[model samples]
Target: MIKKAVRMKLYPGLKEEYAKRHNQLWPEMKKMLKDHGAKSYSIFFDPETDYLFGYLEIEDEERWAQTANTEINRKWWDFMADVMETNPDNSPVTVDLEQVFEL
Candidate 1:
């Protein structure tokens, strides 16, 4: 399995909404992530900077990218765009993070 992490900026003052949305995430979206070999997905928020950090474990990077192209993922992106920085297609403007150390 490969571990991946990404960073993005969240819209100011939307932390609560962001957390609430994920807390009530759709079932279909969850299933899609699982089907795409995604495991232990998590998101962390930095209150001071409003930066969002996401991490996940995947079996195949290619499959993971393909999974995000699904309708469920698209819908999730659209739903989240209101509280996060997103592109025209509703995808977050993400910065890939390099893994330096893991214990």
Candidate 2:
């Protein structure tokens, strides 16, 4: 398995709203991610900077790319765009983090 991490900037003061949305994540979205080989996923927020750190474990890292083409994924991105720094396609503006150390 591979561990992946990404960083994104969230809109100010929407921490609770972000958590709420994830807590009520759509079933189909969850299933789609799982089916695409994402075994585990999590997002952490940094209050001071409003930065979101996303982490995930996948069986095959390349398989995770397949989720981008799914309709459910597009819908989710569109829904979240207002609360995050996103690109023209409504996808979050994310920077992949390099793994330096792990125990």
Best by TM-score: 2
TM-scores for all candidates? 0.96, 0.98
lDDT of 2 by residue, 23-95 (tens): 9999999999999999899999999999999999998867889899999999999999989999999999999
Q: Top lDDT: which candidate number?
A: 2
Taken over the whole model, the C-alpha lDDT of each candidate is 0.92, 0.95
State the number of backbone clashes in model 1: 0
- How much is the lDDT of residue 55 in candidate 1? 95
Q: Write the residue-wise lDDT of candidate 1 on 1-103 in tens digits.
A: 8999999999999999999999998999999999999988999999999999999999998999997679999989988888988989999999999999989
Model 2 / residue 32 / CA error / Å: 0.2
When summed lDDT is taken over every stretch of 10 residues in candidate 1, the lowest stretch is 60-69
